[model samples]
Every structure is written in structure tokens, then in C-alpha cells.
Target: MQPFELVTVKDVPEAIRAQAASETAQQGATVRFIAGGTNLVDYMKLNVETPRQLVDINGLPLNLIEPLPNGGLRIGALARNSEVANNKLVQERYPVLSQALLAGASTQLRNMATTAGNLLQKTRCMYYRDIAYGCNKRQPGTGCSAIDGQNRMLAILGTSEKCIASNPSDQNVALVALEAEIHITGPKGERTVPISRFYLLPGNAPERETLLDPGDLVTAITLPPVPTGAKSLYLKLRDRASYEFALASAAIVVKRQGTRIDHVRIALGGVGAVPWRSLEAEAALHGKEATAANFRAAAEAALRKAHPQTQNGFKIELAKRCLTHALTQAVA
Candidate 1:
């Protein structure tokens, strides 16, 4: 929306150098890199972001998906959402991820969206999305209107009084269930964050969202090999079926040994600040005889700590129902 300078970097090193120089210019001075530009451009238009310089990383070798040695997949940051979702290997090995992707925005948007961008896409909260509203995330120290406002789509976990914005990516929800690792490269060096730790809780700093540094770029996402990922299910409950954000959703991967559940991974979306992995729920079902009672108990354990707002209080029960149904379907 505002005037900006565009610089195209030839490689990762050059991009790093450019980022450091820009940071030295001023604190939080507008500087960002563009990949697909679908999310970034839209945010810029909304004035939520006003970067002075744009670095293009379109020429980098961060666009390929590689198979891991341990029978898992590592997805490059630049791999288009459509490409990754439609890949035979991904579809076969991580059907829950593929299903989540298919349930996201749209085919056209997926074609233009990158895996990294999807992870970094800003919250879809009406207050944060609109500049006119008082959103602490957009304008720190202002206020969060969604706290007491219409909050049917807000969060129930990792939320403070200042902010309740929910992470909007369906892929991240499935990644949490799969126990994925995020590979990041920055000025200091390279570091890996379990996708679980990539997103931060709103604790007292509602403005800060992720653990990424100012110039850090996501390299790849590595998913651990889970025997049940192929048979997993991602169930989304919303006002409408297609193209709508989830009011509550469940990603369930269950591995059964005979009639007993050997391993279970559960993650929730549209109900938390981050992709919420329910260890309590997993513990409830792990090594237990898979049954309707076990699934219901697991769902109850998962939602026990949920703190929902006035309008969204139903999310606790909805998430429970959804998780129960997902667990049943995944085992079937």
C-alpha cells in the first residue's frame, strides 16, 4: 500500500546480509521477504504490515520436497501448498495433512500459497484483520476488542486478556498431530524448532507471534514417521462445510495393536493460539482398549482445561465431540 524498495537476492547468504543491513538501518524498520506474496501483500494492503524493503527469495533452492531416510517426508518451505498436498508420497503417507489442505481456503489460493507462508500467515481475527479495530496484536498497547466482542471464532488456549487470536492454518494443526520439526536459517545460524514450539503463546506479549528471528527464513518442515498417519483423520466443525474456518477441529492419528490402541496423537485447531497437541488426551487413550468409552474419556480429558469466551463456550463441547468422532474414524 505504501511506497517500498524491492531487492532480489540471489542466494541465502545474500538474503541474510540484506536482512542484517536493514535491521541496522532502524529498529523494526520495514523489511520483509516475499515468496508467493499472497498473505504478505494482503497484510500490507490492510496496513497491518508496512515494510520499507521487500527481499525476494524466489531464486533460492528452498522449493523441493525430499524423502527422509527414516520413511518420512521433509517439505521445503517454498513448495506450493497445492504441490505438497497433491504429491503422491504426501497423499499416501500423510493423508491427514492432505485432507487438512483440501479443507483449507481454496484450490487457487493453495496453488499460490507456500508451506512457509501457510505457517506464517497472520491470524484471521476480525479485529486483527481490520486496521480500524483496536487489536493489541496489530497495534500493541491499544486493546483487544475480541475479548468481549463477538468471539465465536476466537481461541481457548494460550490466550491472555490482551489477545485471543487463533492460528488459521489447517496444515499446522495436522503437523502438530504428526510431530513435525521446523528447520530455520537466520543470521546467527541454523536452528530447528519442533513445529509445536514454533508458535508462541500470547502470555503477556500479544504482539509477538512466533519464535522466528527478524530475518529468519523457514527452510523445511520434517515430519516424523508415524505408522498411523496414513490412516489419520482431520475433522473440522464449522458453520459451513467448505471454505470456512473451523470453529473447532481435530487431527487424530491412532495406531492399534489388535483391539488395543498402541499409539495415539491428538491435536486441536481453531481452539488455541497454537496448534494444540493434547498430551492428556493421548495419555488417556495410549495402550488402552480402543472403545467408544475410551474415545469419550480422551475427548473429555482434552477439553478439561479449555477456557472459552461467552459466545465460544460451545467450542469446548464441540471440540470434544469432534475429537471423539475423529478418533473413531481414524481407528476404523
Candidate 2:
């Protein structure tokens, strides 16, 4: 742990200005915004993150969870995970998201974790977390030890030779499936980015994880209303039943008419450097009969681009099965 200065800001602009003072948004960023501190604090304790100053953004009035005029949902960045999961509207309108939230960490963590905090959640790669080991994500160009080392939990999709760390957010996978939009306020004012574009693949510069800039502050997430007859489900496969990250997980949103699939959205977690939204799988299933055969086909299409490492080859099949089962249940 490092001795750092903690400052609490009273407003959004102040918070943004405080972080904008940082030199850069990359791995060695010195300024960081803290809310809930569930994930950030953990890494800080590990000394993987050594921010010289922490800007406390808990006082800002961004905690509202409201329904939009156009039948969508607007979730404030500061809203707690438990609140979003247990909200009546969320449970009824976006059950996949609620289920995904409940499937994460534990009751205590969900209680303390904020929505934006989870949106900006870091990877859980062993090498990245332990400063002793070389990790491209933690310090770019130092070399990715996981590429040829212990990588059972690393990524198989959206992977590069330089990095193979997997995204660990169950909530992010669901958001990608729902086609959610992220609202951010930065030095240049406000901007909206789709959840699909929020996370970046760990290319040569693995230190950069998101599209957010140095002073960019995520304000809220907006979810467009689902189709009339759409059904959604979130399925997670992990080593343990609780307090464990997913080994393979699926978030599926499907609209079926009789026995035929009308529309579908599929996003995978614990397999990609980012939460992977699979247009390939959705295209495979559209206009097809809602049967096990089509579901299996879609799963195969989803993982066709997977590039597995030595120890994590099982993930390709595991993710395929997870997606197939989720699709089967969603349209049933």
C-alpha cells in the first residue's frame, strides 16, 4: 500500500477537474476517482495501483435509478449494485441484468459496489494483480507472463500475443447483450458510447483497457427498452457456487415467435479481453427454428474466432455450451 492524498469533491465538475490534472490515463496514471472503493481499494492494497491522489466522488448527486420517457432505463453511476439488482423495475424489465448483478461477488460486495465502479472494473488476471510478476496490462511492454505461463483463467477471445487476460465482469456481459449506452462527462463535456465500444481489446498496449480518457467520468448508463416479446437470461459457470469469478458465462436476449427466432443478442464473459458481444451468434440464430440444433450452431459460430492458449483451450467448448444452454432457456 502507498501513502496517498484523499480529497472529496462536492460536484461533478470538480471531480473531473481533479482527475484531469493527471499526466495520462494509461497504466501509470497518478489521479484516480474513488467511489465505493470495493474493487479499486483491493488493487491498491495489492500495490498494483499506486495513485498519488484519490478523488472521492461519493458526494455527487448521481445515484438515481429512473425510467426514461421512451421506455428505457437510466441508471446513475453512483447507484449501488444491490439497489439495481433488487429494484422492481429492473427485475421486471431487465431481468438478465438483475440476475447478472446478483450473480456477482456477494451480498456485501453488491451492497458496496457502485454501478460505474463495476463499469470501470479491472481485470482479475493473477499476474496483473501481483506486482512481482510481469503483466502487460499492469505495465505495458514489460511482457505478458500469462501468455505462456499459468493462464487457465485468461482469455481465449479478443486476445493478442501480447496479452490474454479475460474480462471478469458479469454485469458488463449483460450490458453488452442489452446494447446499453454509457454516458460520460469529461473535460470536453458530455459524450455517449455504446457498452460494446466502452472496453478495448488488450492489443500491444495492454495497459489501456477502456475508451475513457484521463478526466472522463462516467455519468450514467441508458438501456433501450427490450422488444415486446423478448426473453432474457444470464447463465454463469464458475469453479465455485459463490464468491467466485465465472469460468464461462452467457447473457442472452432472444425474441421468439412460436418456434422461430425473431431477434437475438448474445454476449459472453470470462472468455474475452472485453465482454464480447457476438453478432455472429445472433446472425446464425435469426429466422431459424428455436431448437437445440440451431442453438448449437449459434454457439459454434460464437467461438469460431476464439484463439485459445495452452491451458485455457477448454474455455472455447465451455463457453459454447454455456451460450447454447442460455439460448435454449431464454426462448423456452
Candidate 3:
């Protein structure tokens, strides 16, 4: 990694001031925030990220994991993945999130990775990592090499002609399924963003990943209360059992009333430019019978608009089976 000025901040406002000087939150941001440094360091080592200044927010008071007054959960931005996953409240109430955390990197990574770092995790696309290749995400307007190159592990759902890199975070997939809200503090003031509006599709600007501005510091994420009979789980399908990213993974929360499905929230990872929340799949399952056929139909509805690349056409069916089986187990 190249030489960079590191500034440690004790509060959110200080961190915001340090980062707000950046022009954009795009790939070439000269100033950036660093918490866990697990993902950012990897890119820095590859020279994929060349930030001139690093705002370290580790000393900030943002590591709390507690219950909200409304019976929901508030996960601080700096909360360790292992701490959140093993917490009694998270294990019992948000098992899908817990499972996804455990399904992420490895035990060592889980212990070090923070909530905000996972929130802003970058893709594992090979083309984007290697500077020799042309990647719109890495260097905008140069062209995406993965469009016709090695892209078996890239995205299929949120593909534009410019980019097809998959979102590679298990924690985010579970967050999208739970309809969590992101709390942020920036130069202007504070704001709350719904999970649906958090990430941007790689339509024209693959360089800009999330809605985060240059100075925006993620404070915490709030998850609303789960429904009464809601059953949640995470299922990850990968080439290996550990130390590998998901090929297709599902985070499902299902609630059944008698024989009819009342509540359903579906989010898939390793399949889209973002942690994909399948409203179409949820629509198919709402008030429907919890039968194998219904689950199959819902899975089909989820992948109806998939735009598979040359080598990744199998991901469409693989994602479908992954979601269907996850839904089945969630309801059962």
C-alpha cells in the first residue's frame, strides 16, 4: 500500500469533518473512512484503492449492540461481526443475520470485521481487482472486461451493460431481508436511509457503489421488530464450505398462519449488484399456500428478469433452487 495520512477521530463529527473534504464517494475518493480495514486494506494492497488520507473511526463511540425502545435492535456501526452474531439477542431474534455473519469470511475475519465495514464491502470480481484489466467499477468509462471475460461469479440480476459485479456481503443480504434502516451523520446533518435505497445499481456509474457521500459516517443500523410467528434463516451455497464467497445464497424470513403464508421477506446474495430484495418473490408467496409448488413459483418469479452472462447462465437456476430451499426451510 502507498503512503497515506491516517487521522484518528474520537467522535462522529470529527470523522465527518475529515472525510467531508473528499470530492466524491466514488472509487477514487482521496479521503476515506477506515474501521475494520479488512476490505479496504485488500484493495489498497492491490493498488485498486489509492486513498490519500484515512479517517480512522475505531475510537468513536459506535460499538454498542443493544435493544431499541420499540423492541427492535440497534447495531452500532463499529460492532464486531462475531460480537453481534454471538449476542444472545441476535442469536435468538435475528438468527438469519447471525447465520449470515458466521457464513461470512472466517472466524478470524468475523472477529475483526465491523458492521459498517461489512456494509461497505466491495465485490470480489477478478477483473475489478486487477488494474491490468478494464473495469468500469475500478476505473469508470474504460469499459468492463468481465462483460465477455471470466464472469462466472459475477452478477445476473442487476446487470447493466457497463458492470456485472456481484455484491459480496453475507451480512448485507440479511439486512436487506430484514428491511433494516441505515443511520448516517454527515457534514450537513443526520439522515436515515431505508435498506432499499442504500445501494445503487451499477447502471451508469459503477464507480459509485452506495448512497454514502464523501463525508457520511454510518452511525448504526436499526432493525424493526420481526412479526409474531416469523421464522428466519440463511442458506449459502458456495464452491467450498468455508473461506469462499457464496455462489448463490438466500436470507429468508417467513411467517405462516395455519396453512397460508402471511409474512415473507426474501433477499439473495452472490447474484446481484446489490443485496437483492425480491419483492416479486415475496408477492408470489404472500397469502399463498406453503407448498413445494408455490415455493418453486416464487423462486421463478425472483429470477424472471435475470440477465445472465455467457458463462453464468447456470446462476439463474442455481439462485432459484437456493431461494426455494431457503423459503421451504424458513416456513417449515
- After superposing candidate 1 on the true structure, give the runs of residues whose Cα lies further than 4 Å from its correct spot: 22-29, 228-230
Question: For candidate 1, lDDT tens digit of each residue in 1-332?
Answer: 88889999988888877766555322343688788998899988988888888989888899898889999899999999999989998888888999899889888989989999998888999899888899888777889999889888999877898899898889999999999999988889999999878888887777777887777878889988887423688999888878888888999888888899888889999999888999999999989998999999999999898889888999889999999999989888
Q: Please provide TM-scores, in order, for all candidate models, with all chains considered together.
A: 0.96, 0.99, 0.99
lDDT of 3 by residue, 94-164 (tens): 99999999998989999989999999999999999999999999888999999889999999998899999
Task: State each model's CA lDDT, in order.
Answer: 0.87, 0.93, 0.93
In terms of TM-score, how similar is model 1 to the real structure? 0.96
Better of 1 and 3 by lDDT: 3
- For model 2, residues 1-332, the per-residue Cα lDDT tens digits are 99999999999999999999998765478999999999999999999988999999999999999999999999999999999999999999999999999999999999999999999899999999999998878887789899878999989999998899998999999999999999999999999999888888887787888999999999999999999989999999999999899999999989988889898999999998999999999999999999999999999999999999989999999999999999888877
lDDT of 1 at 216: 80
Candidate 2 residue-wise lDDT at 42: 97
TM-score of 2: 0.99
Per-residue lDDT, model 2, residue 29, is 80
Q: Which stretches of candidate 3 lie over 4 Å from their true place?
A: none
Give the CA lDDT, 0 to 100, for residue 228 in model 1.
Answer: 46
